[model samples]
Target: MTGLSPVFPEAVLWDMDGTLLDTEPIWDEAMDALAARHGVPMTPQLRRATLGNNSVDALTKVYDAARLPESGRDFDADEAWMVAMVVKLFARELPWRPGAVALLDLVAAAEIPMVLVTNTMREVADIAIETIGAHRFVATVCGDEVAVGKPAPDIYLRAAEIVGAAPGDCLAIEDSPTGAAAAHAAGVPNLVVPSQIPVAAASKRVFRQTLAGLTVDDLARLFAQARTDTPA
Candidate 1:
């Protein structure tokens, strides 16, 4: 078993996408299908731009890039379609990142108040929680549930509020630059686990660590060590 120093936070906030679930690949496939159906190229840059954004934000980015005629279309409809496609794809391939379940169980057993903070819609978030059996979270905050999404701090701040913890007292676990930035802006210390995107240097400097497959016991030990290591 790997050793952890036992550094614990009053509460923890989790990022949903690549961090907990290996849904990025499914997203890519669905995006490709959507682009093909719409006769628009799903370029690499376009995909990267939408990586950590909400469904509506991503669809807006795509719509702007493809220059599709408005057709008096409701943006929400396009977003719903994309989310529906993703839901169908994920139902067939319920992917979870390595160590996600173990880590979640460990934290839950420790009775650490946990909340899910994601750029996904509330509907998509619910599906993910059910798929991963992560419904134990005290609450879940989605981009669509907030006034703004990642890199805006609104979601993280709201999560902190719901958890009854100061942002500084909560630990935010993220895998994307946008999500990490959001946590940092909310005054929450973040731990990053790189996924579809690399953690930027600035984020690296601020994050507690780039996790390397930590278990619940490992986290408890880490928190203990952190307490000891922290200056009195």
Candidate 2:
């Protein structure tokens, strides 16, 4: 038994953007504006590549796509601009993902600690947190606070450390391939609820069409199944 639940996972690590909230379209708008500012359009391919990317990485990709001179690029300035634009869009209305609120309530009722683990910077993520209610999380770990973002284990590892749980003992809820890959690299089993793009099947990963009507027991089952599916 872990915490108040008779399950292997002691805590839940949640992704913010597409997992808990429908903020991807907001990001699309901001990234499109950014691409236009750089004298290029936001192609479907570029948008897909930037999904789940941190500010720095996404900005770099945008610059590359624009064919901008590397010597003339200002990473810090561009990152600030992007975050500002996203924050402006986020301010309008932050919508929750389907069943996200209900599932959060169920998990809280079970007395399991939850942490917000996102590749978004604190400035931008705080707005979404407000919509989701900061009271629901025990901690919030962001990309700017870590040495590296998703697709690397640093963010997930840091989140686990904050909650004092081993990676394998934590269940991650992710919606993007980048986030799932990070959790997998950290040895954490994740329940993948794809929001925009399809995530390929892999060890320590389980899929769900949506979070609608998911129960606490389902979480336990998913965690156990991922552990079982993983190689010893």
Candidate 3:
């Protein structure tokens, strides 16, 4: 890894699912299996709409598509089922986004604090953190840990607080519109790295940069360049 200039932000906040781990497809496959078991057909459109949302939101989307009556039954049971399915799927394979670990380590080595800000529940986030061996990362703040999930500034703000950085001084790396919006609402500069799902045009306008395939070395170089351009 190339040495990056120390011009990086005081802290960096990360989005978990598509941003760090390639768990989106795993979620899709598990959801599909769940739908199949229930004799409901899962469609790509339905899956896409639920991208980046919490499990409850995703399950509600699936339930709506199947026209399942909103029975006052404990929906938490369904969430638990979904979580178990995801855990089983992950046991078979845990994919990480390219250069994710490298980039995170680069930032860490630069002495910049980092926190995971995810809409995933704390239990799920803990699993992911353990799978990724995320001890090197500073902290993780899950949606369940906050009052609200993404599209609201609460989670991001909580993450910033954990990292002890003001929103303006922190950079948020996100892969979805809802996540990007949350970062924007939190007043943090965002960088979008689009995944299998598309980002909205309105959301795209707020980001400081859009990366095609950023590597750890690339981020290091960016900071290095920034530092070089700064006057002594």
The residue ranges of model 2 lying beyond 4 angstroms of the native Cα positions read: 1-8, 230-232
Winner by lDDT: 2
Q: Which stretch of 10 consecutive residues in model 2 shows the poorest summed lDDT?
A: 1-10
Error of 2 at 63 (Å): 1.3
Q: Which stretches of candidate 1 lie over 4 Å from their true place?
A: 1-7, 69-73, 203-212, 215-232
Highest-TM-score candidate: 2
Runs with alpha carbons beyond 4 Å of true place in candidate 3: 1-7, 37-39, 202-232
lDDT of 1 by residue, 1-232 (tens): 4563454777888898888888888888987876776678899988887788876667777777777777734687777788788778767767777878878888898889999999988777778888866667898889988888988899999999998888877777888878877886887767777787776644222333435467765565444443233223
Better of 1 and 3 by lDDT: 1
The TM-score measured for candidate 2 stands at: 0.95
When sorted by lDDT, best at the front, the candidate numbers are 2, 1, 3
lDDT of 3 by residue, 27-118 (tens): 77887876775567878887777778776677777777777777833468888887787776777757788777777777777677888899
Note each model's CA RMSD in angstroms: 4.6, 2.7, 5.5
In order, candidate lDDTs are 0.76, 0.91, 0.73
Better structure of 2 and 3 per TM-score: 2
